[model samples]
Target: MNFSLQQPLENESVKLVPLKNNDFDALYQVASDKDIWMQHPNKDRWKKEVFQLFFEGAIQSKGAFKIIDKSSNEIVGCTRFYDYQESDKSILIGYTFYATKHWGTGLNPSVKKLMMDYIFQFVNRILLHVGAGNLRSQIAVGRLGATKIAEESVAYYGEASKLNFIYEIKKEDYLSVS
Candidate 1:
């Protein structure tokens, strides 16, 4: 079977559904908080126009998801599975952000665990690109046992390139982590 990035993924805490055009308002509700983007590479993404472009790119990726809080049944964040490298047998999981209210909770890892559990079935490695200055995300990925392998320039879908730290986790390593 072909690897499908937008497939519905869920665990006890959250559900990741394939993003759709109509999901704009709901997702924007979660993303509009300036604090949500404070540590993100695109800090002003909370604005309507900027987020519109970001949302547009997400739609085009065909791999984006609107994350939902299972208990509240409300949109809480967004993430994606992108840049699948066939030759290297790897896929990237990134463009992730969660509502500030969810921060410091176990939601991030819970969400990542669900994604890793699903994606590891199809690839040997998973990669993440975090903004160089985004300490929050860097620490989160580190907790997942991903090592910072390199620093490189990563251009957003339609935006300029920015410095990013590439973190990688091998399937064997992730599996061995308790």
Candidate 2:
């Protein structure tokens, strides 16, 4: 399993770099705020310890990356492909959290374009489980052309349980749109 894959993907506005230890400080600075994870199952409430745990989890996950702003060279958010099920030939892409300032600024579509383009190159399907009440994320996934497939609840942040809407986009469907 060659998970140490390095694929520097970019769009005009943002860049995706394989997250490394050196990125910890900057990533923490952006992700450390409780408000950022309000809708997230992994609520940190802006606590340092919680952010550390979040960072450690991402480090262990092979496909995680830091989302950067090209012009400003700032760490704006994080995104990743985890929960890989090789036998099913599928991977999940979520746990995406961006700063409030970056919201609704067209940065998401650019990031999605880069990620979906990259993932479609290797996987047959990409799945996204968004918080059911997180309408913002649901709309974002819909805009990316993924279809709703199922729904279920899962524990988040060790205590808070949340309902998630499962969305999937097959390679063929993505290619047709791209």
Candidate 3:
């Protein structure tokens, strides 16, 4: 099967739709809360101008998605699958953020499980890069059964390098768990 990030994915709790140019405003509404980015590498993303650049990159990536709540049919957050390395049958999933209201609600795992179930059909491994200081994200990925493999400085689109911990989950391990 072909691996295409533009494909829409969904589950009972969330729907991952291919992000469109028009989604900037609705998605931003969920992202604008300062508490949402407090632990993120770029806390200033709550600003319109800063988030505009992020929205631009997401549209350009062609692999980003606007996460929607299935029950409310409202936008809740955003995430993306990037840096696909076919040689190793691996891809990285990162740049994820959700509204503070959605935090600790199991939304991250719901969204990630949906993503993993779809992507495992085409890859052997999936990686996630979480900001080094972002303990919340680190713990979240750990709960997803991903193992920390490395730590390095990652340069996000339109942003400077930030220390990040690399977590990896192999298809076999994730499959067994599910």
* lDDT by residue (tens digit), candidate 3, 1-178: 3769878999899999999999988988988899988988988999999999888988888899999999999999999988889899999998899989899999999999999999999999999999998999999999999999999999888999999999999999998989
- Model 1, range 10-95, lDDT digits (tens) per residue? 99889999999999999999889999888788899999999998999899988899999999999999999998888988999999
Model 1 CA lDDT for position 32: 93
Q: Count the backbone clashes (under 3 Å) in each candidate.
A: 0, 0, 0
Q: Which residue pairs overlap in candidate 2's backbone?
A: none
Which is better, 1 or 2, measured by lDDT? 1
Task: Please provide the root mean square deviation of candidate 3 (C-alpha atoms, Å).
Answer: 1.0
All-Cα superposition RMSD per candidate: 1.0, 2.2, 1.0
| Model 2: CA > 4 A from native | 1-6, 155-161
All candidates in order of TM-score, best leading: 3, 1, 2
Clashes of 3: 0
Q: Estimate each model's TM-score.
A: 0.97, 0.88, 0.98
Candidate 2 C-alpha lDDT tens digits along 32-121: 777777776555535877777667767777678999999899999998888777787788887788988999999888998888887676
TM-score of 2: 0.88
Q: lDDT, candidate 2, residue 143?
A: 94
